[model samples]
Target: MPKIIDNLHEKIFECSLKLFGEYGYNEVNMKRIAKELDIAVGTLYNYYPNKQDLFFTVLKKSWQQTFFKLDKVKETNYSSRKKLKYSIKILYDEIENRKGLGKELTKANVIKKESLDGIKDRLDGIIRNLVEELKKEEKIDIDKEIEERLIRVFFLSVIDMLDKYAKEKENNIKFINYIIDCNFK
Candidate 1:
C-alpha cells in the first residue's frame, strides 16, 4: 500500500518558492528544499527531476500569477495612462517581492532564451496597448516606425529600472512619469 501525503506537490512548491526567493538559485538545492518540507529528497525528485526543473516550474507558475493580474489591469476601464501606470506598479512590486529572482533565473540558466523572450514579448504587449490607446486618441504625432522604437525603448527602460532598483518604488514611479511626460505631454 502506498502512503499518502496530502497536498505534497503544493507543499513542495510553496517551500521551494520561499526558499528560492530568499536564497536564490545557486544557494538552494533539492536536499535543502526536502528538508524544509520534511520530505525525502527522492520524493522531491519524483515531482521535479532536478533543481532546474523545479526552479523553472516555480518561475513559470509565479509568472502566470503576475500575468493574470496584469491581464485584469488591462481589462479595467481606466484611462490608458492609468492602466499603464497600474500595470507597471504591479510589475515593480513583483520584482521587489521576488528579490532578484529574475537575476537568479538568468544566472542559473534555468530558463531558455526563447522562454525569456516570450516573457518580454508579453510585457511588451502591455506597453503596446498603451501606445495603441494613445494613438487612437491622436496623442502621438510620431511615425509608426518611430513609435514602435520608442515603445521598445520604454519597455527596456522599465525592465532595467525594475531589475536594478526594485526597492526604490518612489524613484521608479517618478522616472516612469518623466518618460510619459516627455513623450506624451
Candidate 2:
C-alpha cells in the first residue's frame, strides 16, 4: 500500500539520521543505512541517487530543526542581548552534542566545500541580523562596518572555542559569559 511505503520511507530517513550521527558522514553508506532500516540497498538508491544526496538531505533536515528553535528564540520578548546569548547557547549546545559527528563531517570528502560555505553564509546572515537588532536597542557608539566586523570576530571566536574546548563545559560557559559581558555591557 502507499501508506506502508510512506511509513517505510520515514523509517529509512530516521535510521539514516541515527546511523549518520553515530558513525559520522563518511563512515555511513547507503548499504548500511538500508540494512539498519531492514531494506535493500537498491531500495535506498531508489529514493536517493547516492550517499551524498542522502547525507545532504539529512543535513538539511538538521538545519531546519535548528532554525525552528532559533525562530522561537527570535520571537521571544527578550532584550537583544538576551536573544543573542540564547542564540549562541543554542549553537554551542548543538555543536557540543554532535562534536564527533561535526568533526567527521568537516573531514569527509564526499561533502562538497561549497556546501559548507553555504551553511556558513546562512549562519552569518542570522548572526548579522541579531547584531543589527542589538544595535537598535543599545548605544554601541561604533560605525556600522566596525560593528559588523566585531560581531563576525566574536562569532568566529565562539565557534573556535567551542571546537577547541568542547569537553570543558565550565570553561566554555565562562568564556561565553565573558564575551557577552564585555561586548553587550
Candidate 3:
C-alpha cells in the first residue's frame, strides 16, 4: 500500500537522524542504519542513491523544518526588538531541541559545496530578515554596512558560544537568560 511505503520512508529518515546524532555522520553507515531499522539494505537503496545523497536528503529536510518553524510566527505583531529576540530565541530553542541542532550539524557536515551553500543561503536569508525588521523600527540604521556586519559577527559568536554551552552537563533556562542579558544587552 502507498501508506506502508510512506511509513517506510519516514522510518528511514527517523532512523538515520538518530544514528547520525548518536554516532557522528562520518562514523555511521548504511549497514548500521539498515541494521538498526531492521530493514533490508535494498529497501534503503530504493529511497537513496547512496550515503551522500541520503545525508543531503537529511540536511535539506533539517533546513526546511527550521524555516517552517520560523514562518509560523507573524513578525508584524511584535516590535522589531521583540521580533529579533524571538527569532534568535526560537532558533536557539530549535538548536537545543533534540531533533534540530544535533541532527542539523550532522547533516551539514556530510554534504559537499552545493549543500553547504544551500544552508548558508537559508541562514543569510534569516539574518537579512532580522536586520530589516530592526531597521524598520530604527533600532538599527540601514545606511551603515559596517554596523550590519558587526551585528552578524556578534550574532554568530553568540550562537557558537551557545552551541558549546548547550552541550555542557548543565543546560537550562537560567543560563539562557544569562546569555541574553549578558550579550544582547
Candidate 4:
C-alpha cells in the first residue's frame, strides 16, 4: 500500500520556487529540495522526475501566474495605456521576484532555448495586442512590423535591465509609460 501526502505536489512546488529563487537552479538539487520539504528524495522524484523537470515546472507556474494577473488587469476598466503599463509592471515584478533564475537556467542549459522563446513570444503577443489597441485608439501612423520589433526590444530590455538592477522597477515603469505615451498616444 502507498501512503499519500496531502498537497504534497503543492508543497514541493512552493519549496522549489523559494529554493530556486534564492539559490538558483544550478545550486539547488533534488536532494536539497526534498530535505527542505522534509520528504525523501525518492518521494520528490515521484512528483518530479528530475531537477530540470522540477525547475521547469516551477518556472512555468510562475509565468502562468504572471499571465493570470495580466489577464485580470486587461479585464479592468482601464485604458489601453494603463493596461499595458500594469502588464509591464506585472512582468517586471515577476522578473525581480525570480531573482536570477533566468541566468541560472541559461547557464545550466537544462532546457532548449526554443522553450523559453515560446514563452517570450506569448508575452510579446500580449504586449503587442495592448500596443496595437493603444495605437488604434490614438490613430498612430507607425509601421506594424516596426512597432512589433520595438516592443520586442523593449520587453527583452526590461527583463535584462530589471535582472541586472533590482531597484529600477519604478524607473522601468516610468520609462515604459514615457515610451507608450510618446509613441502610441
Best by TM-score: 4
Which pairs, if any, clash in model 4?
none
Model 4: how far residue 44 lies from native, Å:
0.9
Using TM-score, rank the candidates from best to worst: 4, 1, 2, 3
Total clashing residue pairs per candidate? 0, 0, 0, 0
Worst 10 residues of 1 by lDDT: 102-111
Best by lDDT: 4
Would you list the C-alpha lDDT of every candidate in the order shown? 0.77, 0.72, 0.62, 0.78
Which of 1 and 3 is the better model by TM-score? 1
Give one digit per residue, the lDDT tens place, for model 2 in 1-185: 32245577677767877787777886888988887777678888988999987877777677667778878888999998888878877876765565444444346375887766665676777777887788778955557776767667655665577678757766876677677667654
TM-scores for all predictions? 0.83, 0.79, 0.75, 0.86
lDDT of 4 by residue, 22-44 (tens): 88877899999989988889999
Model 3: weakest 10-residue lDDT segment is 98-107
Q: Give the Cα-based TM-score of candidate 1 against the true structure.
A: 0.83
Per-residue lDDT tens digits of candidate 3, residues 51-94? 88887787667667877777655445876656665666666665
Q: What is the C-alpha RMSD of each candidate to the true structure, in Å?
A: 2.7, 3.3, 4.3, 2.5
Better of 1 and 4 by lDDT: 4
How good is model 4 by TM-score? 0.86
Q: Over 4 Å off in model 1, which ranges?
A: 1-3, 105-108, 143-167
- Name the lDDT value of residue 67 in candidate 1: 90
